[model samples]
Target: MDFCIVDWGAISSIAAALIASFTAIYIYFQWRNQKGAEVIANEAKQNIQDILEIIKIVSLIRQKSSALERSRNFIDFNRLYESVVRSSLYIDDCVEIKDFKKAIDEFFNCCLKFKEFESLYRDYAQDSKFIAHVDSEINLIQIRGFNIVNTLIPYSIYQKKFKFRKK
Candidate 1:
């Protein structure tokens, strides 16, 4: 009778190699997923920054409009209107920003109407009704800006909290 001997050492080495390959593959996939997540987070942060810049432009328009109201000068009014129209192009694509844009449109339309009446009576154009309408539109813009900023706060907090973990 012939007896065959099993090579236990060879079997153990093969098993070890298989386990190491699997671990390496798993780690590679996990790293790829983490990189994807980081890219998404960075994009979100950039969007927030863009929204903020739009808000600043809107605020500038509001300030200029208010000044034009007080000064009752056509030059300032034209400048303010031009600024609002120009800044609208920079507004980010978001729900709150859309609302702000709507308010700006309404305000611009109101200004046009006011201009029509200004030729008849300058004082009447600056009446309480006109002031109130402008005030409401400005308030709406402010509210929308605040809401957009509020939405970004959580992302900022998350980034700050998790930034160290990536390192």
Candidate 2:
């Protein structure tokens, strides 16, 4: 007679544990990926909103207005600018976004120059030279602002839904 020992019970137990572990790990990863997508989508929505508000404020700055109205515009824009800067805390700032920020800073500097020019020479506000300067500023802003808009457009969540086109 020959005697041999085999542990079938132990082998089955080990196989079951391994399968359970693998399934758990797979589920965990899938959940994590879903959460990540949600976060990115939320961030995109927020960043796009901030950018649009900034653009609108810039538009206001371009328009000719009374000194009091311009002062109100300044107040509004200051608040918007601060919000945009604060948004960087949650937003994943890409190169285009960073460029947009730099553009905003430059615009604020231009705004200051305009404000001073208007204050010191209120009569000159309608002068050809001042009007020409404002026009030149508008021209520069059009070029720079549109370029940034192009880059940031891709980040908008509603592009596909709204059927946006590339220009």
Candidate 3:
């Protein structure tokens, strides 16, 4: 009877140890999963915010371009071209969504320079050649911007396949 009791005690101790170990492992994994999820959520939020900001800047560029056409001075045209080229370089260097955001931010800075120039230049009417030059530059900027957007769309789709969202 004493031997049976000792055996029962041994079994109970082993079972309790197993349960505790399993619980610890489970808790560790659960915490890891939660941390992963939070990281993804934060990334998503930042990415979405970046995209929205880029969209806003693009919209502003379009609006400003329209008004800029009336300005005979081509001062903003050179700046716009520089910005577009810089943005193209940025896009070429990008490998991920966050890189994309950085590229877009660079592009936004360029657009803002163009915007600033436009605000200053649009106050006057000067020469037909200047107006024409500005118009041409705007066209080029539009084409390049569209290309960047097109290139990014596929990447964003591919990114969706990854568990960018932590579950």
Candidate 4:
């Protein structure tokens, strides 16, 4: 009878050990899955941030283009066109995404139209009254776009260089 009781005790202990080992294995796999999920979530967040920055930049470019269109007579179209070109290059070099191509194409179209008006507006820069104001506005637009581009740079390097500037 004592031998029978000892055998039962040993069997129960082995059963408990087996259960604990299975539980530990299950927990490890669950932890691994959770870690992978967290990594995916973080990547998604980063992608969203990048997309948002691109959207804001595209909107700013559109607004600038609209302003230039309205100020055709008041602004130096050729200089404004050149500013747009510079911004396009900045976008292309800084961001590899193709979504900006449309905004860039619109800007190119504006440049082409400005080319038609180039012969007329080319000499307008010599007129001190128009040149001064146009140059100021052009500089403002260029600065705005350039600052926004600067913002798109990774937060690590970008923040170091452009800490106080608002985009």
Pick the TM-score winner.
Answer: 2
Give the per-residue Cα lDDT of candidate 4 at 120: 40
lDDT (CA) for every model shown?
A: 0.50, 0.56, 0.49, 0.46
What C-alpha lDDT, on a 0 to 100 scale, does residue 157 get in candidate 4?
Answer: 32
Task: Report the candidate with higher TM-score, 1 versus 4.
Answer: 1
lDDT of 3 by residue, 74-155 (tens): 3334444444445444433432344545555555555455445455455542656655554554554455455456545544
For every model shown, what is its TM-score relative to the native structure? 0.47, 0.57, 0.41, 0.37
Pairs with backbone N, CA or C atoms under 3 Å apart (clashes), candidate 1? none
Per lDDT, the best of the predicted structures is 2
Q: Lowest summed lDDT over 10 consecutive residues: which window, candidate 3?
A: 158-167
**Per-residue lDDT over 88-166 for candidate 1, one digit per residue giving the tens place of the 0 to 100 score:** 4333231123344555555556556534433433454347776565556556545654564464455444542222123
Candidate with the larger lDDT of 2 and 4: 2
Off by over 4 Å in 1: 1-5, 65-149, 156-167
Worst 10 residues of 1 by lDDT: 89-98
Deviation from truth (RMSD, Å), model 1: 9.4
Better of 1 and 3 by TM-score: 1
* Candidate 3 local Cα displacement, residue 86, angstroms: 17
